[model samples]
Target: MSGNSRYRILFAGTPDTAVPSLDALVGAGFTIAAVLTRPDALVGRKRVLTPSPVAARAAELGLPILRASRLTGDAGRETLGRIAALDLDAAAVVAYGALVPAAGLEMPRHGWVNLHFSLLPAYRGAAPVQHAVIDQAAQTGACVFQLEEGLDTGPVFSRLERDLQPGETSGAVLADLAVSGAELLANTMGAILTGTATAEPQRGEPSLAPKLNQADGFVDAARPAAAVAARINGTTPEPGAWALLEMASAPAEEAGERPAQQRVKLLGAVPEELPEGTADLPLGDPLPGHLHRGRTAVHLQCADGTVRLVQVQPAGKKPMSAADWARGLPEGTRFQAEATAETATEGP
Candidate 1:
């Protein structure tokens, strides 16, 4: 809005990440009438009725709250009723899991706007942050756009881009983006109120970022080191990237053609430098399952080359240095190959 005007805002979002945007809008002089967040639900092992971080912050700011399941039927009608009653100029959504219906989207005098995690027309979906890392993107950023019917198909209003660092995790990237986007949201709303914000249609090829799951963790060893590293960092602290490794000494007969016990999650890695004198092994020669070092590094042979595992978290174990896990590995153990491998052999 202009320096002279402050728009009445109805805010919707559910996580701590959304807090900065909400607060920035308020700080930028927008009048936040009400906040719509999901109802309290069980989270974590305790199954406690945990309030959303956004809701808690809203309460502190003394704004009214509407905890609804969605904007459809009773829930939708109820939310719409509240919005109409608020007489808001517009609504701002940031990572709000619930869908905004057409009626709901049009409730405010102006219209709804969203603070999305990625540049529009790219990484448009539920898990954009994770996907960018998985794809080994060179860069990614946040965008503010007009809310539309299709998922993140909104018209762009403003954007802030950043380079993707080699060691950055999705969680870290999102944390920074949320803060940056929050400030941008405030600025955009300010401009809209003042009639300075300009809207533009999204350009470039659109990409999808589907919700990540446990199975998304499987990464082929045949992929390049850079790609593998990106996947490992992108899926951290959640549905992590993993690959199968079989013990080397297991009977070739029992292992069939390929030997592998199960999948192992990769948490951290660094590229290994080729030795000076020895000839570099081809992708298929040494195979992918060989645990290269006794400890400190996992020298798994992959498609393009080898990757050293710096840290890892096996299915049930806590995350630890790969060196520690190596020492803890059972003696006389043999590494197994990927399920797709035709022949598994113990590394000499």
Candidate 2:
């Protein structure tokens, strides 16, 4: 705790990513008047009611917790009143999920400061990190900005940049950003208290990163191998990338069964180079969607090249290595490419 103990701030966020910022603020010695997170919701296969990650962490910190899904309805009025009573100097938000209404925004003297995961003016919606990974960006960063009614369109106080590692998934990048960005948020708060904080208008061509859906996770083999690999990595661990596996025919034990069309999730994938001296061979140039099962790995042919499947999860089964999964498949098994309305365009 520093001399900044007198500053009372409301912490608003709801995910594991937000937990770090909350912890940082408390560790930095500011008074956390209360924590605002979404209400508990059913989670996992057991349908157990689960608090948001921030709520759970706040409980461990013995901090007051206020759960609300939104700040605009009748229930929101009650939440707003509760917030107003706190007499907060400012509110810090990180992946809060719900938008703050105009009335609620006015409750804090310094307004709300948000820690957004992307370099604003670009990837400015719900899925910034995921969209950046899917777009195969060379670099991406986080920004601490003033939260306004406009969608992440406020002036930024501070930012930190990190280069995208080769083959890194969105989940991995975000986890790292959470920790570094937490420090940034804490420092920004310190600057705010000392009257040294400065925010400038964002400068860049704005781009949108709308929330990704199940359809966005569909892996189309008609795309180039690099694109397919990017999509798999981008959506890993959430609405996971998947494709329909079309078996050549039923096994001898189930001879009468219709050719199996199983939906399988691709857990790990990467573009691969063909074996030495085989780059120009027909075996190395498989048609789109063709499955080439090698001795230890399973490869899929894409529009321009081959992508190796490192891991896969069959419906109703736990994830397994692609080699292990491919060993049991019948010959001529291949991924079925679904026709999509639009293929993913290049760049962010």
Tens digits of per-residue lDDT, candidate 1, 165-224, equal 886778788899999999988888777766789999999999999889987777666555
Alpha-carbon runs more than 4 Å astray in model 2 = 250-259, 277-284, 339-348
Candidate topping TM-score: 2
Backbone Cα, N, C clashes tallied per candidate: 21, 0
lDDT of 2 by residue, 1-348 (tens): 478789999999998999999999999999999999999999989999999999999999999999999998899999999999999999999999999988988889899999999998889999999999889888899999999999999999999999986567788899999999999999998897778999999998999999999999999887877888889889986768999888886473377765668899998687896555433236544556777777777778777678888799999999999989988987677887653314422222
Top model number, lDDT: 2
Model 2 lowest lDDT segment of ten = 339-348
lDDT, residue 343, model 1: 32
Error of 2 at 61 (Å): 0.5
The whole-model lDDT of each prediction reads: 0.77, 0.87
In model 1, the worst 10-residue window by lDDT is 339-348
Off by over 4 Å in 1: 1-5, 245-263, 271-285, 331-348
Instruction: Assess candidate 1 and give its TM-score to the true structure.
Output: 0.85
